[model samples]
Target chain A: MSQALLTVIGEDRPGIVAAVTQALFTADCSIGDASMMRLGGYFTIMQVIDYPRDLGSVEMALDPAIKRLNLRVHLDPISSVALTADMPNTRVTVYGADHPGIVAGVTGALAAIGFNVIDLESESSGSAERPLYVMVIQGYAPEGVESVRKAVVPLREREGVEIGVHPIEAAVF
Target chain B: MAVLSILTYPDPRLQRKAEPVSVFDDDLHHFIDDLTETMYAGPGGVGIAAPQVDRPQRIVIVDVRPKLGEDCHGLMVLINPELAAWEGMAVGREGCMSVPDFTGNVIRAERIQVQAQDASGRERSYECEGFEARAIQHEMDHLDGFLFLDRLVSRKIDLFRRKQYQK
Candidate 1:
């Protein structure tokens, strides 16, 4: 079996997953690491699957998802990715009245300082008139956590958002 | 006392509820000592449960000073521990020796009061907050056959690769 990246998007519905997965099952493909969720009424899936056949077989297997769900799909043949030793050890949470450039300015500053973002989850919790954007990022920042705490200070002040950087505590044993 | 081997995830023994200790004698004291030794022997170990070492009994050892700094109770050996009361809530990341590969977000009470017996069968109670409370709840979960993965935040696959960032 080999690995391939498959992405799918369509109007949110219950059968979207069942349809796609059933097709893959029939094609002798099994999913590995996957992220499937609904974003603003549009359902999306980004996953790596271990397939028994070639990329064309995957496209053929996804025919049901396209025709039945009226979805757009893309299948890419990608080799298994090499993982870096680095994993996210810090948790950065940003929240403020929704505005443009919040993601850009904040992430840019952290990136310039060599922060590798591992997992990020963001959402707007308030109304459109008073939008509140909140994002939590997990990353590796080897340049010192104090510098990480300071990296987004300017952006926090300028955008009137709260940006907190702290090491993620892992409770072992 | 010897450092017993820890049981990793998917071990059916870990899912069984640990029996409550009815006797706290010399055997119990020695078991607690071995548990303490095992907790310190594991990489980044700070808390452990008896079932983790194939001892299906309500016992746990914890010392969070290494993780939470000086604000924690140095070393606690809780037998048949139970959460007496709890208040507030917070989400924190946790990794377990049993669940070796994945770490995930768990939402637990911020402040907690616990009642349990010591090795000598002496009753004791503890009041703690923050990471200390979280650690106790985590260990107690083992007594009830639950891991952090069972109480994940929002239940949206919050699990992540457990990584070591110690420099």
Candidate 2:
């Protein structure tokens, strides 16, 4: 079996997933992991699938379904890699008035200290005249948590954003 | 005391509702010992429910004293525990041993009153606030076959990867 990354993007509408997934089903491909959501009136899908046959055949099979849904699809054959079960130990949240380089400024500080970002989500809300940007990041810091926290202090001051770094403790119950 | 194996998710047994403790005998005592050992053996383990170990009984052990120090009520062994009253609300992140690989935000009562029996079969009642209250609520949910995933405020936003973050 081979692994393939599939991405689908099109105007938000019903039946987009049904059509795309139905095509994969018909091609005898099994979805391993998938995420589908709508962002700014556009529906997007990112999925990893396992196919018994070659990548070209899978693309050929999905072409008709893509055309019928009026969607853009990208398919790439990717090497399968072993996934680790390590969990993130820290959570960083930054939110404040919208700015030009908040993401770069914050993430750059994190990267400098060898902190790996495991997940991040950012959104701009409120009215256009007074926009608010919020970014939540979950990651691991091998260089010690205090060092990472101190490094981002400058970004917080310059960007005038509220920043908090908390230890992620998941109590077993 | 022995540390029993913890049952992980996708196990049909984890979904089954635990039975109430009708007889508080020596067997029940031993079971609680093993359960306590198992809970402490887990990484950052603070509590354990009987059902998690595949014993369908209404028993749970918790000790937030280690985490909260003198601020906590120490180790508590609640048998047939039930919530009597609760007040306030707070959202906290929780992860379960039975349901590994993910964590989620859960809104629980900030303060709670519970009634239950001790290991000696003596009736007891206690009021717990803050983190202790949250842990009790979480463990009690297991007795009714409810995982933290069921109480998540929102699946799309509340659920998060346990160790890694991916878009």
Candidate 3:
């Protein structure tokens, strides 16, 4: 029932995951949740892993493995305490002609209003006719959606692009 | 007709290629009614395919007009559709009932021309663009036994956290 968070970042290369995961498996660690990505030349990973209840306590066990990987590792033993889960959130996707400061300006406004962003993904597409910048942001309003609605209005006016925000609840199969 | 239970993933029924309608029969009509009812009953579900309702037939109902600002042509029922040709690729995040609890970036054709049959057995061709095209393509993939998961660009780019709503 002990949980730990592991993050791995390095130059994009094969066997990085295999090396890291093999270490976890050898230690009898079970990966509970994880995400890995390749951004240009960098590879990054974030994961939550669980270990046996009596696995050599927290700091003592993870140090040697951290040194061996020659990778930055952070470990925080999860507490049994329960934190109130945040309200379910939604996603908004915006894409149009590319322009400067799109991400900084939009994200700046969002962060100002205390809207917690869960994930934000962006990509560029289109040919010479008009290069496009597309961004999809998944965020939540812990205080409720009214503030989120108000905060985004000015963005729409200044950005000259449409923003679509909908409350999305994950469907359980 | 009543709201039918949506068949989710891990249901072997969703993976099989849907059978084409051979002859117009009462069974076909009944399936259409159920699909319509199920589409409307689900929250924000603008379309439904036969495989979603366990019928394994090539049929779909779509109505995107309700999505604000989308302003798409309303109410289309496509039966036994064939993709003639399509142009352009668009990467967009798509979610499905079958895969519930996940959404991923999928690259799909932005404009498509399809030939299909209507309820009355009339041959019809459609030139669709924008969101309508996306919905049509999503539904048609079901007929071919393909899900949005198969079209994911990369696991790193499109995965998201499941949001919960507060009372």
Among the numbered candidates, top TM-score falls to 1
* Tens digits of lDDT, candidate 2, A20-130: 888899889999888888888899999999998988888888888788888999988998887763567777888899989999999999999888898787778879999
For all candidates, the clash counts are 0, 4, 3
- DockQ per candidate, 2 decimals: 0.47, 0.47, 0.11
Alpha-carbon RMSD to native, per candidate:
5.1, 5.3, 7.6
lDDT of 3 by residue, B24-136 (tens): 77877777887888887876577788888888889988777666345666777899998887876655667887787778667667788888888776888888876678888
- The digit string of per-residue lDDT tens for model 1 on A1-173 reads 88888999999988998899888998999998788988888999999888997888888988867998899998888877676558777888888999998999989999999998987888777887998988888889988678798888888788889997878766665
**Model 1 DockQ vs. reference:** 0.47
Report the Cα lDDT for candidate 2: 0.85
Native contact fraction per model: 0.69, 0.72, 0.03
User: What is the per-residue lDDT of model 2 for residues B1-167, given as tens digits with 9 covering 90 to 100?
Assistant: 99999898888898888888889889988988889889989865788899999998889888887688878878899999989988877567899998887888787888889899999889999899989999999999989989999988843354232333111
Name every residue pair that clashes in candidate 2.
A87-B163, A88-B163, A118-B165, A119-B165
Q: lDDT by residue for model 1 over B117-153, one digit each (tens)?
A: 9888899999988888888889999998888888866
Residue-level error in angstroms, candidate 2, position B161: 18
Error of 1 at B144 (Å): 0.9
Candidates ranked by TM-score: 1, 2, 3
Please estimate how well model 3 matches the true structure, expressed as its whole-model Cα lDDT.
0.73
Off by over 4 Å in 1: B68-71, B154-167
